[model samples]
Target: MAKSVAVIISILCILAFSGLSQCHEEPEFFVNGQVYCDTCRVRFPTRISQPIKGARVAVECRDRDNGTMTHNAIGMSGDNGEYNLTIKGDFENEICEVVVMKSPIAECAEVMEGLNRARISLTSKNGLLDTHRYANPLGFITSNPLFQCTQVLAELDLSLD
Candidate 1:
């Protein structure tokens, strides 16, 4: 009887301390990227590009074979248009992507064609020991080109017309 009581107390103590704090445990994966506004209407970021603040981004993982969604997480961009989303667990055989959901600015509300989603690998089997995975910048298009975009596009050898 005494042995059983001691065992129970030991488990209770372990549960109390371990469950109370998990500060040392590192997350399985972190998805990091930035949201940008394509002011040049060139479908990509340039010198005249603007960082979109308060943009909504999502991490969506789908089954590779069946094409069914397996995991989903949402994150909001900060003042600098940067977002870091924590994704738990390993998805060895899944297709994961970061997609732009919404742009807070009315002028930059339209999704940039071919730049809406950026693919990312979420598997540990890829031999990358780093937990930080970077996704390509996702952007939205502005209704009209910004004033400076004209000269900026020319300097960069790009044209929206």
Candidate 2:
């Protein structure tokens, strides 16, 4: 009977210790960066002094040979134009599509002449962000057919190494 009690206590202790260890574990790792326009062949500058503080951006992972992938989460750039994406458990190996999401209340100034959407795709190696592998600086926009423009910028060739 004493042996059984001791075994039960040991099991409980192990479970408790394991839980505590998990609490101390670091957060799921991620990479943060900004999207830019591919200006001709050169990359557009990263410094934004404008008031584009609430621009929305999305990174959609597209599966190869399979249909369009789904990423329930979305990210937005801050006033300084920066974003951090948390990529975790069960991410697929595929090319990602990064696009700009239109705000419900878009301003006329925001809609510039010859301005379109932006997109980029690359081979993601696990948790690393491939700043170099990005979509075309000029993205296509079929969302608004009335005044669609082909706005292109340089948004590739970023290196963290």
Candidate 3:
């Protein structure tokens, strides 16, 4: 009876210590980003940024050594054009990028070259203590600039000078 009691106590102690260890474990990393529609067709986001809602975005991670893909996760922008992606697993030796997948709006369906994908670092090895990484805002360009875009661009140019 005493031996059984001792064994039970040992098991309980192990479980207690394991639970304590988990309390200090590192949390999963999250990537927060935004998507925008180039309303003025300026090829870049302006001060009057039009956030694209329901835009599809994805993060692709490639193995640094062999250049093979390691992970891919997709997410959609909310009403405010924001997305929060949870990256699973450690990608210490991987190159990650956020790419524009698709645009929900018909007018902004074309993905502009050079502005489509933004490279991001997913691993915490960069000396960042926080588990959240913010990627540069990705955007979609319209095939044709809006009629009011000319006036807006002129105003922007005037403000710049």
Top lDDT prediction, candidate number:
1
Candidate 3 structure, TM-score to reference: 0.79
Candidate 3 C-alpha lDDT tens digits along 1-161: 99999999999999999999986665578988889988776678876658999999999999888989988999999987999999866678889999889999998888878888888777667888888888888898877666677667787774222
Flag regions of model 1 displaced more than 4 Å: 1-27
TM-score ranking from best candidate downward: 1, 3, 2
What is the clash count of model 3? 0
lDDT (0-100) at residue 51 of candidate 3?
A: 90
Give the per-residue Cα lDDT of candidate 1 at 145: 87
Q: Ranking under lDDT, best-scoring first? A: 1, 3, 2
In model 2, how many backbone clashes occur?
10
TM-score of 1: 0.81
Model 1, 66-117: lDDT tens digits are 9999999999999779999999878888999999999999989999878999
Tens-digit lDDT string for candidate 2 (16-100): 9999998654334243554333222222333221223455666666666675775534776564445565654333455555555
Model 3 per-residue lDDT at 104: 96
